[model samples]
Target: MRYLSLSLVVVVLVATIGLGWVFDFVYQQYSDPKQSPSEDKIEYAEILTKKMAVALSSSNNANAFITAWQANDGYSLQIDSINSLALPAPLLSDLRLGKSLNIESDSDLNIHYAIPNSSDVLILQIPYTIEDNKKFINRYWVTSLFYLLLIVLFLLWAKPLISRLINLRETAKAFGKGELSQRITVGKVSYISDLESEFNHMAQRIEDLVSDVKLLSTAVSHDLRTPLARIRMGLDTLSEEEEPAQRRVYEKRINAHIDDMVELVETLLAYARLDQSMLAIEKTSIDLFALTEKIIKNKQKERPAEHDKSILLEADASLAHCFAVGDNTYLKMLVNNLLLNAIQHSKTTVLVKICCRPNSLVLVVEDDGDGIPEDIKVDLFKPFVRSKANKNKGHGVGLAICKRIVQWHQGSITVEKSEQLKGAKFIVNLPSVEN
Candidate 1:
């Protein structure tokens, strides 16, 4: 494409130079003669005037003046010695007022002379008229047509190649964003064939690595969970009366450890399934406002009596009618995780707000509690990441799962300080179905 554009530029430069030369040549041909008035036709006119002056001085006869003018091809002249010429008003006035002595015809073909010796004046006209050079004009037009054809041909030739390159770039970008299944299609351009082949090999390798990692994670979780479950069962079989408090303590510790293991396994499984290619997404247009209301109501039912009144749900009615393109189950999971996290950490009030924007559906959950610690905020989305400040809370898989789910939906999740309340705010931005 660069070479083609350069070639086009060169062609345009050559055409411009050629056209300029042709126009210069035409201008030179039509320009006034370089010879002075005394050397060219003007000198001839002066000689004829002298002859007419001598003829009139010797014989006072107008016939000799006419004969002298005719011998010099003066018949084509508009201004002649026998009659006073009707000059343009300005020129005639200038001449009568003694400001100038020459007059030119309207076409600049003739030079009229005032002899000051005879009533008959002398007029000298050149027989030159500008004619259009068809050959030169045709050459210019042909060159222009050739330049236009070259541009059209370049576009026709490069369109597919350019599109293929762009598609390859987009596929690489998508793969970088975790779309491991994407592959570049073959194109006619042989220049990037090696690149395409390498890219395909890399994508295949990535897919294999991801598959192996997932299989390994699944295997590890299954193997570890079985032994962990056996440990729990063995602990449960311990007698309660054999140091009852100590046995109860031992059982609680074992149960807590088992719970942590189970949470870790669940988190791993969720992360592994975050790949959209692995997921069977059944996208449907869901009314998000009603869905959110339903989630809040369910949460209210599940929470303690005092907490039910503390949950504040505020949604724009107009925005409540909005829809989103997503797997309903995944959407529900996302909402539930965010709300549960907020409710668990909230001190007094938990606020849920749903609003619709031009490009996205916005769900914000804010809690009036100690916000996430500033130090651990950066690693909050990573699996099993728990801040020392909130370490006693449930295992830190909820936020990671939330991140994975939002990413799979091509949406975003961000944590910040709430504007309306002094607490942590979790904002979920899902792409609008209407958009």
Candidate 2:
């Protein structure tokens, strides 16, 4: 953007100056007729000679007028006998016919003019100097050369801009024609670098959305089949039964299958909502230790009697107020999902720890069960991805939701093997905010 603005300034300045100069140049020729310095000087000499002739015509004032002018005017005036000097035939004939004669010398000492006065000549002398001495800077061909230089400079600047625009146009055309992976490449000093960056970012987002849609379509088709078949089986059985108690039992079984399908649809919708919620999340400072304590107690109360695993939160009392700036509802959901995932996978205990790092607050959830299998651990946060052992259980979007929540908060989450518990450990670092 800065480069674009600076180019605009240069273009405006050059155009304004060039246009003004051209207008003034054209106007000068039409508005005023110019004369050469030599013509003007000859005209002045003619007037002077005529005035002196009139003054010398009067015998009473002739000597006084000539004497006064010789002392004041910067000219050499003398009366010479015309018969004593040998003169050219053409000049002498013109002089005898009452014409004035201007004599130019090759050495450029003086301009001498003669006028015939009876048997003598009136001579007037002045310096032979040229006055129309102009510098060759803004004249004809130099001006053309200046404008040509401007054209060359502008082309040098515009070449890169035009090339970048062409690249952007072609990349956009390719993307429009279903090339979702296509992106524009530009240099750091590019005129439209920001525009290229925005295009790349938007392209990446659309590509991810399309990929998620395809994954959801495949998952819905594959996952809904078993519940739908069970529902069909229960409906067939209910239709065959005659007794009221037996009919109620089959009806309840069918209702259970319907409920499972409903849950599946809702969980998928929730996963979709997480993507959109990024734009509307309301942020506030949250104390992670306090929030996690409530989530652990609630999960403990909600766990079934047949499950004996314990949920424990371990954090230093001094660092209990680990404030992180993010949406309260989503942060709570992030903790709940991680804790729930651990509780479900562990055999004896699920441990959650909140600790402080140099620049962020860390939240860790670990389970004391068999560590995550290497095959599924890589893509564990992806939606609809489930391990071999839990393939028939949940919807498999819980950890995916957790990952999205952490991302929206500008935090990071990673899964590893727990050194302390020898089980799967989920580590999340949320950036801390000042009070």
Candidate 3:
């Protein structure tokens, strides 16, 4: 059964149980002898018997006995019962002895009659127990069963509505998880018509955003590459005898422009690949400290002076055996960017520390140079963002790319003040595979 059907069944069962309790209460009340008129009738018969006996003993006539009996308190003489002469024996005995009796009547008719040599009248109240219980069944159970069946039928007929609701929920979940093509298709069910409309609108908006990003990336890559290619061609065509100072200036300018173009293209590509569906990660256990050492050695070869004077690798030798689950290529790229950024900013000493914490591997790179300004630190990881202090050094894609790479690895990177050194510290925390 569907959820709605189950809910309705529960409601019906509860109502049925409630009705049963109410019937039980009413049955108990109706069955009580004190609430019936039989007890009153028996008491009245007994009083009439005492009055009649006194009148007869006084040597009065039958008419005088009847008058005395009629004069008793709370006693009414009915013509139908007296004429019928159908009084029960038990009631007659009570009337003659001036004692109380209890009786029950089932039918509408009752019997009242006088005894021999006495004006006392007996009242016969027939048993009505079976009829009373029958009334309860007819009055309550029949109507209750009818409504319960109707509720069950309604719930069964609503199966299509419940199914549509379940489909809509699943579609919403898929769309939320980056499936832009997911749509809710509920045919002819007007109840969920509004939700279906809203879902379509949301899906359309998501598709539009994805399309726009793809188009923008393609156009920007094509448009920007043409100028960079032309600049490189012009530099290649420069004459050998050109003024040395002017040629050097031109070379620097051309190289700077090319660097700028490359940085812009890389940043755009990284941003476009932020969604997990766009990239596949092949994870393997890699020694994190060894990876860091390899990246540091490679950077030393690329920028020998910067590495020799400034960079320092302080890692526990034991941590060299520690491993993490990540794509090694992306992990290398992430470490390279952070180390390069530190080398560019650090003045004298750049410390790279790797250690293992419970459930996580921590890498801290601190530079003993002027730290980043507080105002610009918040925007450090944003694409195409740069600080005035480092504008001449290189493009600011390094940190943004680092951030994306760390996120792809299911890790985190943050900047803070280094306690042991007077500079900025970049901390990278990755899940520890060893544990």
Candidate 4:
């Protein structure tokens, strides 16, 4: 629409300006006063001056001049007051001195002479009898054609844009009425192609979010049943148990179920918070190398001795302060989740590598354990997607949350088979910044 409007404006300016140029050229050629008096006009001035002198010889005024040439058709004459003429003072002086004057006329092809008859000025004019043989374009016809063409062209330009806008409005209405799949078909060079593309993207994002919410609700309802069943069973057994220790055992089991439910609810709330706050990320410069190293060391120290695994970190010496632009809090969460996930599944060593590219920093984490199986790999990053290895062990939202955090920072996270560690390798790439 913007492009079309600009084109219309340019057309208006060019057409009007071009027409003005043509109009001015024609007027200058056929209408402006001629610059030079012709030789015929000089000869007529001489003849008419003498003729007027003889005609007005008696009365030396206009009444004698009028009576002498009233029926004359060889030329035309008119009397005018000296004060009414715009002739210069010198020209008037010459006229009074009995001299005839020749001058140009406003019509490019006409010339006339002025003669003083006594105290009066007699204007001698020969009618211009040249008729135009060819039909010439006048302003009325040209202006009508300009308006007609402009209207037709404007309608042509408006039709496509109006149709697109109508389609857009209807699609928006459908989407507003809960048609989650509604989307506009994009055109190659539409005036509002960018707007269409953005709308499509927004629709897709909204659909995905709605679908995730439904899935989350279903998963929550189904997942809570097991713990609730266990809690119920524990309570029933506690009422039947006679010994204090047996009663205490049942209490412990019931408390554990309640704790699991609390944890699940807390995880869902946290995810909700993260989703809502995505656009409000508090951006700051962060030293990714240092941040990742600190997370790795802290998790390594926090792990129990019995489930020990050698956690390793590797990077070039120059990457001690590799900088990136992002919210530090979420970046820490992303790094922590990846590391915890690595430690949970690793059979031996959990290896991490940090490297810098021309415009980004890459962090790779690989675990020396069974890699992601082929069956569950497709939706491994979606919320609550559990692998057989970790089935019923933990809610499968860690990877999904990590993925969201990376995406919120305008980065990417991917997992593949590890060549070096013979397990899952997670790669995260974030835009780098100078320190």
Error of 4 at 188 (Å): 7.3
Q: List the residue pairs that clash in candidate 3.
A: 104-125, 104-126, 105-125, 105-126, 106-126
Q: Over 4 Å off in model 3, which ranges?
A: 1-263, 270-278, 316-322
| lDDT (10s digit) by residue, model 4, range 338-412 | 988888888889999988887788999999988998878988888887866674368889998998888777788
lDDT of 1 at 4: 47
Which residue runs does candidate 1 get wrong by more than 4 Å? 1-148, 151-252, 276-278, 305-309, 433-435
lDDT of candidate 2 over 32-146, digit per residue (tens): 2554445786778767875665456555655566576676546666666666557788777776676777775652223223343466566666655433223222355556766
List per-prediction Cα lDDT, in the order shown. Answer: 0.68, 0.77, 0.67, 0.77
**Model 1 residue 281 lDDT?**
76
Q: Over the stretch 1-435, how does candidate 1's per-residue lDDT look in tens digits? A: 454466557656655676557666866686556534333655565465445444444565556545555665434433354335565677655444423244445444454544454454445555433332343465577667656765676576567657768888999999999999999876664446667877986796577557647654655666477658766675766643388777787777677768766766775666556664426877778777778889988888887654644878787766745788788888898889888888777778899888888778899999998998988798687555667677455656678778767866778899999877788999999988662
Q: Pick the candidate with the highest TM-score.
A: 4
Error of 3 at 129 (Å): 7.0
- Which parts of model 4 are misplaced by more than 4 Å? 1-174, 177-197, 316-322
Local error of candidate 3 at 8, Å? 16
**TM-score of every prediction relative to native:** 0.50, 0.63, 0.47, 0.69
